[model samples]
Target: MATKEIRSWAYDELIRSPFALPQGMLGRLAGRLMLWLNDPGELVTLIGKADSVLEVGCGPGGLLRNIQAKRVCGIDPSPDMLRQAARHNRGRDVELRLGTASDTGCPDGGFDVVVSVNNVAMWPDLEAGIHELRRVTRPRGRLLIAWHSATGRSPIARKNALPEEKLARIDHALGEPTRRYELKNLTVLEKHCQR
Candidate 1:
């Protein structure tokens, strides 16, 4: 299937909602809401000054703004989200682009750290997305995948938190996680190095 068709199928079968793939007027509105709902300070601290960072499914670039990287780039499938992200990170050196997890238009081994938050479950092909993300990460680099936490304070987090089985699937795809822990409203899987 083409990317667009896959996205449409994924929207119905995997995501079942626009909350993951924000687009159009409603998507722009969703981007604004995401700016207020998600906070990236703790994630930034964990990232801790990488030379380059890439955020997959960056949405409105909330985390891109706070990342302490010398070079920062973010990609989302939605042009509307990219527009919002560009506006959100305006006057900053962040690069906002239209791309997806399986086909990020970045050079090989280009990023010190690659992260995806709240959108992994929506990826049309889990293993393919993981493979592409790893391809972009340098040797001994890190891949951080996070999702809403079941124990989070926000109801959205609680509702969206993946089941243990689903989390286990992600862990298997990424190999063993260096650490798996909850940070505020997110449950994070940190994989150190490409194995």
Candidate 2:
């Protein structure tokens, strides 16, 4: 997603509909259930002993909580989203930062794992955000990103639903075959993540 397109989607689609599916009532329930069911796979894999975790664009801290790490931090560019996260994670160990992914205030090698769901492609400077994530992650750390493609939304709440033109912009920006990635490893994008 390009800057304007992603920004618009975040404000219009994401802000308006944080929970539920992008399809309909059944989709919403299925999405909700999937969130819980998929928790162990997404959360557990991003943690390790002696690891400090950082989550970019963490919404409501659900992923943050599910990770089950004592040392964890999160950042989201939207104040509204941060407020929601604060309300949910108040008095918890999670440190929620109010900022964008591209310029998160963190020191080099500050974290052992950096995780994001449904946000990497949305970044205006995708590589910059990736750079930041890599910088914060110590050697041997991992970065995980998840996204919901145009096929459909499991939770069909109102979505900004990018216009075909916007979609084209994103397709052009990211290059061809923006396919789903395997969790096992990244034989691809290794140049971006290597220490």
Candidate 3:
């Protein structure tokens, strides 16, 4: 099979059984490794103090814990991951749900800010995911999409990296972004809604 296909299959398997693949200690270590690799603080900084925030592909609820929003919701394809997120975010105002990026099952214009960090590459359909993100964001809301590039040449980084053309297409679909910038190994795409 092709490399992308292999990666996708692996991702699918992981989503289906995140707790069993790497096994016991190894799985715990791998989860921690992922947590260390994904830091969405920069994305949260851009979010400011939104009333409601939705995070697509939120693994373990790291970003949800940091965000100072009145309401926070996190969606991910892995039930195991969501369970971990629920555990990590105990006593916090957060909701964890099982959903993919393209079909979050959130209400229309329900969030003041929508974010996806380090999860775009795993999206089954990128354009459809973008549309879904836009659909759930309120008019004049903020959208923040970000990814990490300094993953020590990991296959996941290579698989998930957005090409220039794909980035352009995402920008086109979202309309002009309010700001686009890169910090350290992180690249962020932000847009302010007009709809």
Candidate 4:
């Protein structure tokens, strides 16, 4: 199978269905590993006291748990992942919902910032997803999208890395990023909403 096809299959079979992702235990373990691998606190710098924040494809709500904001919302396609996130953030003021990156089911201009970490590769329609994120963000609000870097030379990193073409498309769609940097094994891109 082609690389794109494999990625599509992996996303459909594993990411979209968190319960069946190498079985439940392994899936949970992977989510925990992602939490450890990516520092959710790194996102706070870009947020900078934003009153409202939204995270798309927030698997297990790991990043959402770390963000300090007046209102925080997380959305993911997998009900199993949402259940896990709810359990993890039981006492936190987080709104977890079942939704996709391309269609978040949020109001237009609803949030001060929108973030998606390690989630872009799984977006079935990457362009539409970017537009959806822009739609939900208020003008001049920040948007941060990040993923594990292929430069990490780890199997997981290589598997999760966004294709070069996809990355270019995202950069073009967002215009010029205000900041692009690497944090440990992750690559981040930040931009302000112009619409």
Tens digit of per-residue lDDT, candidate 3, span 1-195? 111121331134424234222224444454566677766666667788889999987777777888888889999776656776788799997989988878999999999999987767556667788889999999999888876543324565555566676666656766775577675455678889899
Q: Of 1 and 4, which scores higher on TM-score?
A: 1
Q: Write the per-residue lDDT of candidate 1 for residues 135-188, one digit (tens) a residue.
A: 999998999999999999899999878888888888989987568978889999
What's the CA RMSD of model 2 in angstroms?
Answer: 8.0
lDDT of 2 by residue, 1-195 (tens): 111224433233432233321223433343345345334353354344545878887755666765666688988765545555676677788888876677889889887777666565466666566667777877766665544434333332114233445444433433343433433211112112346
Please give the range of 10 consecutive residues that has the lowest summed lDDT in model 4. 1-10
Better of 2 and 4 by TM-score: 4
Candidate closest to the true structure, highest lDDT: 1
- lDDT comparison, 2 vs 4, better candidate: 4
Model 3 has an lDDT value of: 0.72
The better candidate by TM-score, 3 or 4, is 4
For each candidate, the alpha-carbon lDDT, in order, equals 0.85, 0.55, 0.72, 0.75
Best by TM-score: 1
Each model's TM-score?
0.91, 0.61, 0.79, 0.81
After superposition, the stretches of candidate 2 with alpha carbons farther than 4 Å from their true spots are 1-41, 46-50, 149-193
**Candidate 4: residue 180 Cα off by (Å):** 1.4
Error of 1 at 38 (Å): 0.5
